[model samples]
Target: MERSVIHNLIAALPVAVVAVDHEARVSAANVAASALLGENLTDRPFVTVLRHPVVVQAVDAVLDPAHVSLPVPDPTLAAVGSGGYRNRVIISARGRDIPAEVTVSALPDRIGALVVIEDSSGIEEAEQQRRDFVANVSHELRTPLTAMIGFIETLRGPARDDAAARDRFLSIMETEAARMNRLVMDLLSLSRVESEERRRPAEAVDLTMIIGAVVATLTPHAEAHNVNISLIGAENEALVTGDPDQLTQVFHNLVENAVKYGGSGGEVRLELSRIRHEPALRGPAIAVAVIDRGEGIDEMHLPRLTERFYRVDNHRSRQQGGTGLGLAIVKHIIGRHRGRLRIESVKGQGSRFTVILPAKRDRR
Candidate 1:
């Protein structure tokens, strides 16, 4: 009933709230309202402070006795009846346009109308991310599915008359099916990694030993490509608290990528070094870098390497049987361990992929 009491009630609200008198002037505005709309909002004409036509109309409809003219039918305004007016609209704040929900309700005793504005930017962004992720997954699966379907039809019809043609088609079909399988596996892995990314792994493990085994396993593949994988700092021990399986996966993907992309240079080197103080990690750390001598990546493509499904050469990546989720997985795995992935490359000198993790304080 009292003017000061009404101001206190509006100010106590968590979200942005503005009250307009029957005369259409801003009678009271909370701190959040000033932060959203602008400073010095009190005593100003509500229409002048909130220039949006739809919002102004909504407020006016609640204060109808003031003789304020209502604009054309606005879809943004959900209701403008006796009880209240509700709206979802975009408002500009600090130079960026954001989704805002505004609801105007008439106050009892004709004190004024209360206007509430809520920012929905985060919800909108998260929803958009979900939609984009679904679209990407659908497209990735469909390409291999389409190819497999075509090959199956040929095998069932034209290729049925010839043994050689059938064998070739079946091989192509098998490859497509395998690609789909890898995509599915990678999707699941990415999901698991993301869900547990916030929890840091605490098991102590040896980086050198893990990389040594990875190198041994991938040696034959390197030999087939005539690329030598020389492991440096293998004799020295560097320990860290981490999930061995995830750490292994991180190195496996990095080393395999080097052997696949930079193997043309005839050498893929796994170099390990100690960082006394990794500024990013803010303490002592261990760094393992996978260096290649083949043609390097362009500077422009470096920044987005960890983004899910981002590929510098999509066709070549597919040919190499890459899921395009390797680096993304690597990024999250390292994050869970409170580490960092550094990528450095030159157009002609090849690229270096480094994994730096916090070192275990005491070695067993």
Candidate 2:
């Protein structure tokens, strides 16, 4: 094949490809390479252009010939031969950092070597999520284990002679066990929401009914805290298409959070509104807002609140019996429903959590 044809063909390939000479100067680069390393990459040292330590190492290994001559086989060279390099390295171009997975190989013509680059940001994100998941699970389990150990020790030693003390310890142990059970159930629900393969069609759902049920169930807690819980706006039949259980869980978490964290004498308000009208008259999207008059979240911590196991105030949250997974679960549930979840707060003022569910389509 002609050189131009070969160049075009290589350039057309999806993966970023670059070729360098024995001196490590870029002799040719494909379209992907041009786009990534810049169009004027020729004559630039592959290392200087790509600027990724791992890519540079692989290129240096292939060009040095010493790597091939070494008595002990180098894994990097073997990876080059197999055409599968999964090295994690940072690439900087124009002062911006880029994460990449690089594959390097010795060219047949000895025209230097071929380096293929693939963006690995998504993969790294997945790995980070996995790590967070494991850590959260361990932490959640540790709480129950610690309580169990403390209670068992009291029953076996200090509380053995006192019947009332032993009973109290046993009750506390039971409560801890129940908390662990709830944690497990929430984790399973979160996993299901995250990994659900089938998308269920949405239907008209009454937001008022869901909110009312949640409020009724949590009213005692609100009273116990001396906080007033009230629903705002007219009780209109607002409807949205989405999973009922998930939506219920979303409201339950939001209201429960307000009741738990809002100051002892503060008020919790749940409001509903519609936005942007349509022909089907599904009504404005059913928006439910949970407002709490409590210590609000800081602006800086807003973005990461939905991250799994994230807590704005770990000690306060734990004291209020929060699982730390509540917001994360609420976010995912809203996403599955094709809705938006937002948190607006001002420190020392209060926090408002809004869930906007798409209006149900009128099948008339």
- Per-candidate local distance difference test: 0.88, 0.77
| Model 2 residue-pair collision total | 1
How accurate locally is residue 113 in candidate 1, as Cα lDDT from 0 to 100?
Answer: 91
> Which candidate leads the pack in lDDT?
1
Task: Provide the lDDT at 54 for model 2.
Answer: 54
Task: Estimate TM-scores for all models.
Answer: 0.85, 0.82
Q: What is the lDDT of residue 116 in candidate 1?
A: 90
Strongest candidate by TM-score:
1
Q: 1-364, model 1: which lDDT tens digit per residue?
A: 6668889998888999988888889889999998888899889998887777788877777777466655556667666556587888888776789898989889886668998999999999999989988888898899988888888888888887899988888888888889889999999999999999999887889998999999999999999999999999879888999999988899989988999999999999998999899999999999999999999999999999998889999999999898889999999999999998899999999999989999889656
Candidate 1 regions off by >4 Å?
1-44, 62-74, 78-85, 105-114, 362-364
